[model samples]
Target chain A: MKQQSKARAHTNIALIKYWGKRDNKLFLPMNSSLSLTLDAFYSETSVELSDSFEADSFILNDQPQNSQETAKISHFLDLFRQTAGIKTAAKVVSQNFVPTAAGLASSASAFAALGAAMNHATGLNLDLAELSTYVRRGSGSATRSVYGGFVEWQMGTTSADSLAVEIDDASWDIGMITVAVNTNKKTLSSRDGMKLTVETSAFYPAWLESAAKDLVSIKEAIHKQDFQQLGEITESNGMKMHGTMLGATPPFSYWEALTVEVLTKIREIRRQGWQCYFTMDAGPNVKILCRYSDAEAIQKLLTTAFPDNPVIISKVGSGVKLI
Target chain B: MKQQSKARAHTNIALIKYWGKRDNKLFLPMNSSLSLTLDAFYSETSVELSDSFEADSFILNDQPQNSQETAKISHFLDLFRQTAGIKTAAKVVSQNFVPTAAGLASSASAFAALGAAMNHATGLNLDLAELSTYVRRGSGSATRSVYGGFVEWQMGTTSADSLAVEIDDASWDIGMITVAVNTNKKTLSSRDGMKLTVETSAFYPAWLESAAKDLVSIKEAIHKQDFQQLGEITESNGMKMHGTMLGATPPFSYWEALTVEVLTKIREIRRQGWQCYFTMDAGPNVKILCRYSDAEAIQKLLTTAFPDNPVIISKVGSGVKLI
Candidate 1:
């Protein structure tokens, strides 16, 4: 086995969101989802296996992780050790490149990088498609982080079938700008939110149906290189995901006052002849999808409009790979 | 025909909301809804039928109305004239007691008072239930304003069967507070908004089903005098109504930054052991549902949190009556 192995993976933003899980244990989605991999945010992880280590240890962003956090990483690493027939303990170090207080999605990149580094250290030499299944066990969206540009997480019936596939190279005029609207910790995690929505919300079934249609249409738009269609579908799909949360038994919203303000500003900018659209995840921040040439201008406008908040611009990014 | 008649009607806030409409011309809602009438906001109108007048004229809020506004009143008065078999023109004078730029639903009170005054002036003398059908034609929600306390607009198959029915007198410890967050005119009117939601939103069918179930549950809560259950149903229903709009094609939201801020404050107050909940309409304003005794205290807290916004408290109001 390799002594040490390092890998890096970039984050991806869902256009047709993967909201609910059909199989929680395997992290299988209820519907297929499409996303764009971006250059700004990423996670680089190094894994070292040795006979001298007492137990598995995890260091994240230069800080030692608690037992609970370390256990999660160790449990994930066990899958590799079981396949390779080894009982060696490993020490993992991960550094996240996401902005401070941005509240962005880093778990996708983090788990993807860890999956790549562990695979290399174990000498498994698995293909990217096979590696996605392992990455999904860490986080559902992490499956897509194994590929570059536009990737799709197919909602397969079995664990072996559910895998990420690259759709488009995203080499054209595609760009993203993120507005960090709030720094507070989220009251509800995405996993808990999606579980409540699936169990309680009456609209969850409809959301799944709409998402399936959106995935088909978005893929067509990507093939045609139609930015307008892609933007509209992405914005509408993101809003629909949040909409289901509002119908839960005890309703909740991830949106804050500044989130809505930034959305309104985006619409106003669009009315002024700019081809920009907005999408939000399970948090208060807003992401603008626009033409690559228009990203800098849009970032400047958002920085001026929200002087206290951080504005970030990112273009198309590559897939997970060894250092 | 009588020379003159005057009537007053109080506004009602929906606990279980009416969103999409089934019949656009007759203003029939897709689902039945429940609401409570409040004393703080109302409309009073006087109607005088005369042979000397050649045309119908309308004076609203002590000012002469323009042609477009006068035409709407004339069109409503034509229904009374047609029913009474009279050709005499009527002079309509209306006064609104709502706060300046509060964005409260005044159309319900306005049309209910107009219906009552016209019923008396034209000697139609229709009972309140029969008058509710006429009031619904002017505005869908106005049907519920014909009665005081808790009222339900039952969705009927035809124009004659569809009418407002009083469910409970609401004489318990029921109270409300209005938070006027924004004074700007809404970009999308409720009529257009519902139309788009019904036509474009994939979740519209689910909303209709959920609303029907909510109407049944809320009525049970009202009957049992279960304040907590009633408040929960009301808040959930209102949020679900707004949620449907977010799923529509070319999605939109009636919420503003201040609107969300006020909601956060209300949630914080609830966490501090206050039995207060919130509901919203097709605009940026928010209304609180709480125990009659807690109204004053909640109002004070909201005032301190949002000093620039107007917060008004109100108790249960009576039904439409002659002056």
Candidate 2:
């Protein structure tokens, strides 16, 4: 039989969150955050041991990766090699199945998929927590993507303790509508942004303090399967994350004119008696969390409201699995 | 007594700093910040009770004031009327002697002088602390400008307790250099930016927790008259404040190309054994804190480095006083 290659993986979105780093090199966070792994948007990442190249090679979205772009991949490969006791080079090719132009947690799904695929390829028999640690080393949010359904990336003080855990299977009533304003890469990377917040913003401490409470409330809401509570917390957290940007000494604004317009429209829709709420992650795009039945109507409304923009409706997804 | 119509006040820079609000309407802070009053930059205002006009008028930098531009003054007047039981209208004209393009704390000076002048006009025997509280109700930072030399704006839980206090009457060796970059106003207002930070930035809490330490250390340095320590702390705090902005969800960058160039040059100069440090407020302009004797040389060096930019040099200034 032809050598079975590692399976592809997808990314996930955090309903709770994982922010800040205890260790820059290790990507260790000060606390854990919870998330829900959605089915519709994901990245298919396959890793295989290759003897041809001296270094790891990454092909992202069917394009050849540059040195800067593959840095994270190489870092992950190095860790994988150290763990698996293999000196051979590896090849990582990822095809993102996430909706075109949809602003979703592609990184979370991508890294989580990669983590699981690489783990399976190496036959490490690592537990979910170990897999999450490896995923977090690649991207902070990816740690939570290791499991499907409702998940949490616990902000443990140490890398050993900080790992993603499944909170609930989320097989029931949860749906999302991702409004894609632009699919172009963000101007600022989350890693660089987090570093900047640690170094500069005066209100950073207050954000950290409040986030813990938000995380706690979100967890409780998730346990109760309270979509309304979950949506509210997620939206509030998203807004809070945006707020820090405004207070940085010299100050910066993440808002495009369209961002405000979309937000206002979302609020208007919410006022119109739809059980819908919105959350944004590191981009101008907004994802509306609502009942699975409401997804179609919300998408239609958003499409009409934002005729120039594209919207993608998705259902609750499964965790990382071999394709 | 020439009607004692003209009054002048100087602005102050917060070395320790105060950020966040307990109450939006009252401008109460979560903690107090310490600052230094600079002799170099100040605003002079002449207020005269007028019977000609039905409303208070303001003239800024020799330009005629419009109603919309005088909103802050109007807000202050309304507050003053409620506090001091004053029913009369006044005409106010103010000139800022400080470099218009420089990012010095002009509002602090403007409001400080305004507070003093309004007090004089109203014959309200409000003490410095009470005056600070009153001014702070208008602008949070203005409270620190009430006192000269080393001043602190205590971030008390309530507006009544959150007042600016005099630390040391900074008679010692301290100098400042203002580097004018872009004269155009920033896109993000400090008020909105700070509010966003408090609401969003994940690193905000860490910043708040550590700020007290920074405040304590910098105060000790100021008490010991250690320019080196003072400069280091000020620069670090300024950088930290700017960092939070970058971490905001969509992320924002307040840096201009010139900011990078100037910062590089400043670092290069420091490597050449100069005891100079830089701090920036909400604008692209930079202010360097150095010893009195080194001010001229540093200014000359900076001017040479950026031939197109204007540099203003000034000494440690006095607080707001009757002219």
Candidate 3:
């Protein structure tokens, strides 16, 4: 077994979001989801296995995590240890290049990097598709982070079948601009929100249905290189996922005042004959899906409108790799 | 037939909102809805029948309406004229005390008063429930405005059965405060919005199911005078209705930046031990449902939070009556 290994993984933003979970513990999503991997946001994780270590330790961004955070990492590491038949404890250090827990899918890259680093450290050389099931057990969206460009996390009936598949190279003139409306940690985690929505929201079933349809059409759009169809489906699917939360008992919304303002500006931008569309996750921040040719122009307008917020443009990114 | 008749009708705020239409021409909703009539906003209309008039004329707020507006009223008046077996032309003078086309249900009071005035002018002795069928042709929500206090518009199989019925007298300690975020005309009318939502929204079927359940629960809450239960259902139902719009083909939202700000402020007010909740229609405005005893206190907080907007309080109102 290797003493230490390091891996880096890029974050992905879901065009068709995965909301409710069919199996919470296994992290099996109720519907299939598709995402575009971006070059701008990622996580680098290094795992070191030692027989002398009393317990697993996790240090994030040079800060030793508390018991709860460390325990979560330790629990995830056990899955790889069991697969490789190792009893040694490991020390995991993770650094996030994106905003943590602000609906930027920080957890996706974090888990993907962790999974890749552990697989190397524990001598479990599984392929990307097989490794994605393990990454999904960490965070559902992390399943897609195992692949590059446009990836789809199929909602298979079992853990063996539910895995990420690369749909396209995403070599076309497609990119994204992330508007950091708020970088603070979200009050409700996506896991908790999904549980609440599945349990209490009457719209959950319909969300699953719409997501299934969106996945099929989005794949077709990607194949046809139809930017308009792909962008519309992306925005509609994201909004529909958020819409389910509004029907939960004691309904909740992640939108802030600036979120609506950003949406209004995006609508105005589209009205000016630009082919840009906006999508949001479980936070107030907005992501504009546009052609790479118009990224600078759209970024300029967004920066002018929101001087306080950070506007980031990212190109198509690659899959996880050992560093 | 009487030379002239004048009638006044109060506006209503739906606790369980009516969104999509099952039958567009008849104005029949896909699901039943319940509402509370408010004393603050209303409209008064005076209708005069005459054989000398070659065409129908409409004067709203003492200003002559254009052909389009007059034609809409004239078309509504035709429903009443057919019932009364009259070929006489009518001069309709209508005045709205509330903000017009602002999602304040101004059309509810306007159409209700017109129906009452036309009924009296043509010597039709139909009861309030019977007249509601004719008013429904003007606007779906106007059917509920024909009655005072808590009223339910049942989504029956046909036009005659899909009429408003009084649920309660609303003698309890309950009222509402309207935070007029934007009183200007809405970009998308409710009629158009409903059609788009029903046809394009994938979440529309789920909305119908939820509305049916909300209607039953809200009615029970009204019968028991349970303010908390009533307030929760009101906010959930309204938010669910708006949620459906976000799933349309080209998604749209009536929410403005100030609208979300107002909702956040209301949530903060609730967290501070105030028994107040908010409900919104197809516009940016928000209405806070609170106990009459807490109405003033809640209104004061909202006014302090949004000093630029008008914060108007309304108590239980009466049904339509002739002048």
Candidate 4:
């Protein structure tokens, strides 16, 4: 049995947010989405299959995980074992530089790295396509982290089809400025939020129907390398997701005053003819998509305006790698 | 002309929110909405037409208003003169206990009172139906203030048909708890916001399609005096309006952090077997609908939790009246 195998992967921000689950068991999305793999946040993980190990043991960020987290990792390892045709127990350890469960897509990198490491440890050597599906079954968004730069998550009906595919290396002068609007833990988990939104939002059906059309336009924009078209659609798509959340039962909002403040400034910059726009995930943070040349300027303005908030500039990062 | 006339009217909270304009000039809504007139906030105005007046001079709260405010009132008065066949300028004095243009429906009471006072001053003797049309020409929601307690604004196709009709006097045990989340002036006018949403939101057409169905269900709920049904629909309707805003071209939200805090608290209370629900207007504040019996307890909780916020308990209020 392999002693150990390791891999690293970066998190990706959805330019077009994937809000709800169509099929929870397979982590199938209600609609297709697009994302950009980021350079800043990442996770590194190692997995070993050996008779010395009594059972599947997991550690994250230097701390032994609780039963729930351990069980989840164990279940994922079982899937890997089934594919590899091995009964050996595994010891898995992961380190995350990114904030976990704070809407920063930490799980994407974590699971993507896990998928790659397991493949390597078992000597299965699955390609990105198989690895993407494996990562998706663990976390829906982790599928996108399997590839670098710009990727598209297709809302396929079956387990085999619903996986992310690379659109571009994002070699164009495109970058993002991320503002840490709120790094605090969210009150509602994304899984629970998706469930609530799907069950209660009156506009969920409309959102589901419109996402395919948005995906089509966004893909064309990517192919054409049209920055304006991409930025406009990206911003609209994010807003549509939040709008659906607002229609949830009892209603809720992830936005803070600072989020709006950052958005207002982004618009001010855009009004000056800069190709700058913003997209927010389930958290209060705002990610501004702009030309690489303009990213520093936008970040500087935001830092000057809100010195308390950390501002980060990220480029197109590399794909998951076995190390 | 009659020497002088005076009237008072209360502000109304839309359980079913009014958003977007079908015809900006006529102040027509694209979808029907429902509202409850509240006793906590109102406007009192007195108008006098005399030969000594050279033009329409207006004083609000013992202070002269700017030309913009003057122009809006003057313009509304012109419509009244055209109907009465009189060309006399008028001196108008107004007092607003409600916050003006801050999403508290000050315009509803202002225009409803103006409509009644003007009709009386000119001896036109327009009834509630005719007066609703007149008030709507000034402010779309003012038509609802023409009637008392609970009101429904039908999204009629033309100027004459798009008028408010009384649903009931709200004699049942019902009330709302007001949370002053952001009493500051809004950055965008509701009129401008409505125009932008109507023009840009992809989900807007869906909203328009579903509004009539919501109206029917809410009306049935009202007739049955089913608090749960009415509360659920009201909460859903408000969320849908905000969701539409999120789909706007640049996208915007009327929520602040405290707004979410209040909503979270409301949901917590609801889970404890209470029939409390919330709705927000064009600003950050939230109005919670609850049984009159539960209003005080809810208000106390909010007041204790958010010491800086003003929490008020309100009951169903009367319609426009000559004073």
> What interface RMSD does every candidate have?
0.7, 8.9, 0.8, 2.4
TM-score of candidate 2 relative to the true fold: 0.60
Question: Global lDDT of each model?
Answer: 0.91, 0.74, 0.90, 0.86
Which order, best to worst by TM-score? 1, 3, 4, 2
Candidate 2: residue A41 lDDT (0-100): 76
lDDT tens digits by residue: candidate 3, A129-152:
999999999999999998889999
- Candidate 3, fnat value? 0.80
**Which candidate gets the maximum TM-score versus the true structure?**
1
DockQ score for candidate 1: 0.83
Q: Write the per-residue lDDT of candidate 1 for residues A150-267, one digit (tens) a residue.
A: 9999988899879999999899889998899986778888899999999999789999999999999999999999999999999999999988988888788999989998999999
Cα error of candidate 1 at position B249, Å: 0.7
RMSD of each: 1.2, 8.3, 1.7, 3.2
lDDT of 3 by residue, B101-173 (tens): 2347678999999999999899986899989988999988899998999999988899998999999989898
State residue A18's C-alpha deviation in candidate 1, in Å.
1.4
Going through the candidates in the order shown, the clash numbers are 0, 50, 0, 0
Worst 10 residues of 3 chain A by lDDT: A98-107
